[model samples]
Target: MWMGEGFVSEIQHNRGREDTMDDVGHRYLRELVQRCMVLVGKMGSLGKIKTCRMHDLMRDFCVSKAQEENFLHINNILSLKLCEVQNNKVRRLAVILESDENYIEGVKFNEYPYLSYRVCCKLELGNLNYLQTLVNVRPKTIQIPTWFKFNLLQVLKVRNKKGAQDAIQMLISRCPLIEKLHLYGHLKKLPEAHQFSPNLAKLTLSGTKLEEDPMETLKKLPNLKILCFRQAFEKISKYESVGRASFNGKNMVCSKGGFPLLQYLFLGTLYYLEEWRVEEGAMPSLCRLEIEFCSRLKMIPDGLRFIATLQELKIIDMPKPFIDSLNEGGPDFDKVKHVHSLVLKSFCQRMIIVSS
Candidate 1:
């Protein structure tokens, strides 16, 4: 999330070596921890911080220092003092209301139907160019009534919409620069190839019903690098077809020349995925893959053995039989033997981490 907002973009620059946005973000966090400004809360098995926080004193002190120095400046001129300004041309607007610590009883949340967060607002994006994040209620919470000519809208996430595919397809047409899109609605159809933004690097969809082979369309995205599907499909075993919708069918295929720039892929909650076939040359740049809650997936794709670029694989909450197939001398062992990091999480909360 910090990476998408350009928070640490200037922290690590041309220092003579390749530095990814992930490395920069982590390094910035480390600096804060070293200075006692932030505290690490939870750490992942991969040594990454999953959660963190800052002391109230530290936060207060930082705010005081920033305000004293007039630090919230854009292009080194316009100061962002938010609430104090009467003018409405600062690009992005987020309303944050701070109240007393006393708790109020029996206060109906329905009383404030106009409230929206990321700092509760009486929401309206009336052509005020800079778009950050607008999280609201159902599908009707946001409406792009007028065409956006100039916007800083890089990321968007919406939920509970019936026509998610069409809505997003129309969105990308107006804000053609959106790089990261996360859809939480139930989709009846996946968007076509030409409907995507050429600059898109990450795509995530959850709880969608597929009518066609999604990979057939997703692979055509020119710059997509990260893809995640969470509870995106449900199982219907009686009516099965090979090479059809992955959830409705027993088999799915990843043909050659697909996902050319993709590097990270995650599939979770796919209950009936039994087989995934990857033809050679598919996802050639893929480095990380994670699969969780896919209880019926019996084996790893044989084509993955040919993807030398794959460096890490993580499987979680899978059936014992599925986990056993990746053991030494097992049928699927040879396919993933070349991966540098292999992590398997069991139902008992036991995790096996292997680095080869």
Candidate 2:
């Protein structure tokens, strides 16, 4: 499942490197599918298998072999025994609690010093130095332990219901080598740091609110390639009109030489965006731009036509006034007519595709 999900290549890509999957990873996945070792699920828009599921028989066989070799340990109980910890040479551990009362309180990591992957709801991460991937864990505050170091860590994903902006920032700073990061929850604003993770290439933020223009800060990221902001901006007005009132003083302006290597940009569900100004030299390498559900966005940035690398532009569920301005002979038609592929969609009608 992990191989089919492209997580391996994704890690390489996030590290600001090309994913050379055609040589080994793709061939291995193909062989697995041909041998009926994996079940293909869904195809992506590019005609590649986007999802796959492991066969039940294969999964059982692997589990039995893993248990036999003590490579992995699955603990469903509320507590762990010191004897079990001392006995098993588990390298990967999965703890699944059957009830809310069950917690990850007594599990000891000293027994399994080589533990690399951990999946649990709660943990005390002081001893897991070799840990490479951490998921479903949220620290209470931003005060990370001075003794903890994620030197080899590549992926960190957290969901904090209370929104730990400072903690998230601290985590990013601590893991200098981290490449892919996903933060989910309510965050009023990101940290006002001058520099962020240098190698970070992909970032996804959901249910976040920014007090300042996000582009002003994000544009400084040198290696960022894919950025998605979904329901992350705060709206000040409910009216379907375009004006400064809708933005609450958060207008985006891309400066010269910004986002030098960015390729994919998605802005969705930003209900109160009023204006976006794109400077001529900004996002020089951008190839795809998508704006969706930003009803109050006034018009397409005229400076976008200056981006020679732009290939795809999509506008979905936007206000009629905004869509009308982009149609043939409309005020903004000339600004976007040069794009190789364009798609516009609204609730009132079917999607329209335009190509040049």
Candidate 3:
């Protein structure tokens, strides 16, 4: 259990569903802490709790309750003994590994279920059928099991170590109900628009290299609400392309009506990005925009002014000139003056504002 900040509420809103924590998400978590049912963990820069851990007693209590209610099963892959009786009636299974020596050698998955693997183990997935959620901790590529069915899968988070773009695309193509996907590691190329998941709501690409303009393809994701690129998107040239030679005069443009439902966008550590253009009507629903460590980027997209729904804009560790241009009476001030909250941060200082 963890303090979701606004993440939980945001997910509910993005899915067009009422928030389960509508009236008291934080209050509920706070009450749990007050009752000693949960232990608080990490805190964010804002001094708000970001994560929460459970005490051993609380954990045991939860596990017992879950088993009694037929809510879920927690399996320890590393400590399983022949004397233990596995519960086959549980519909949700969370597999955890206690050590590197443990392997997924004999886990059965014939029932329609939700499976979460909390370890970086190399396991064959062909025998699993009717899985709803899967989180593979390892970045290694595994062959798709022949008995695997993707139609029922809704959430997938995995890392591809071999830069297997094709393999990822093939998996995505088969999952019609897929909603959230997080892909980590190098990706030489992204899949074409036709192969995109129609219901995909959130997407994250971390530590990947895009051979072409990522926006050109990502913009077509009809229901995408959250888009993030972390240390992703690098310049590829036949020769060394750093500094002046890297993306010398390149630009990325977001076309009109693109990312129709996007609410948040984050671009970080894009070392070679020098220019980004946003066309009017693009990201019409965008509520927050953040750019970080993109030293070469010189300006904020002028078209951002047209996004009436935008409420926040943040620039961190960017070039000094870029931040200066967003200051009051600066060249681009008028373009972003309408945003309710604007924050600009340089190496040693930060400026925050609330528009009139």
Candidate 4:
């Protein structure tokens, strides 16, 4: 049984007693259940139940309510793929809109004035409000209200162009519990502020220009596992407090302790990198490594000696020296024992091998 935060709150408020549908929010929730609205999850204490599907009737009800009052007034409404109700809702509602073109007009963050004052949001939360999961959607630079401050966030998928580093900084500061982060689209600069979240896990940063101590900030994510810098940095020194630190031996540096739990690594078009530090047998948990379009990478860091668990390896579009070195890993190479797949993008020719 999965219910949204709003429903969970109502249930908690009415616990150990008769459940009355007096509150307008509560009434709508009851009506949704009584009507047997085929919601994705369950209807009970807000955080107790989980939702897997969205009910069409629930969506229609919201639209009708908005049309009747000429505006929507609920504070928290969890939505998925409901684009048809875009124009109806007017004010004071937290909503999650994913992959819906029809609701684009009404789904803009600028439409709501109440977000800056309360923690209300349409984002998903399983049992704690500290962690939220953001699904896939178009990239857009959104202004987070001043009041939003969750402690833990598991998933953050923002694919809009307006995605700014400042907003990400604000989110990191507001929600200290961010563990898994995924950023898409062009995020040009890193926040000037020096803040960190130690509980992070998988990170995906794509199509952004790095002008600051992106790695310096990354050092703060002590629990990181998978790292993806997909075009996140072009000039690492632009955002740094000092410009010299950007290109002076620091740009290609790796952490001294290195990533202990790191499992996967992906880098794209690293133009400024002359060397990468693996910290002498670091990243003991690394298994999969993929490099693409990195012209200046001279050789693999010695830190790879620590990876006894590596299985899958991919090297694409690199200099011949780097490719030649990859084949020399000794007989006990962790990848050979565990890694059965090796994909070489540059020199592999198409061949059809028919199996019986």
Tens digits of lDDT, candidate 3, 1-356? 12123333432442555554422456667778899888889863223456899989889888899899987768776555423334544446666677665445545444434555443445556655556677763434455754455776767886665556667777777678787887776666777877878998888877766657788898999989888877633346766433211112257789998999999999877777878999998999999999988887878999999999989888888777788888898999989988888888876565544344
In candidate 3 the C-alpha lDDT for residue 103 amounts to 47
- Per-residue lDDT of model 2, residues 261-292, tens digit only: 88898887776677889999999999999998
By descending TM-score, how would the candidates be arranged?
2, 3, 1, 4
**Model 1 per-residue lDDT at 282:** 96
What does the lDDT read for residue 94 in candidate 3? Answer: 69
Q: How far is candidate 1 from the true structure (C-alpha RMSD, Å)?
A: 9.3
Give candidate 3 regions above 4 Å deviation. 1-78, 82-96, 99-106, 116-122, 137-141, 145-148, 232-249, 350-356
RMSD of each: 9.3, 7.1, 7.9, 10.9
Among the numbered candidates, top lDDT falls to 3
Q: How many backbone clashes does candidate 2 have?
A: 0
Q: Could you tell me how far off, in angstroms, the CA of residue 213 lies in candidate 2 after the best superposition? A: 0.8
- As for candidate 1, its clashing pairs are none
TM-score of each: 0.67, 0.73, 0.71, 0.54
Best by TM-score: 2
Q: Tell me the lDDT of candidate 3.
A: 0.71
Model 1: per-residue Cα lDDT at residue 13: 61
Alpha-carbon local distance difference test for all models: 0.66, 0.68, 0.71, 0.53
Residue clash pairs of candidate 3: 126-145
Clashes of 1: 0
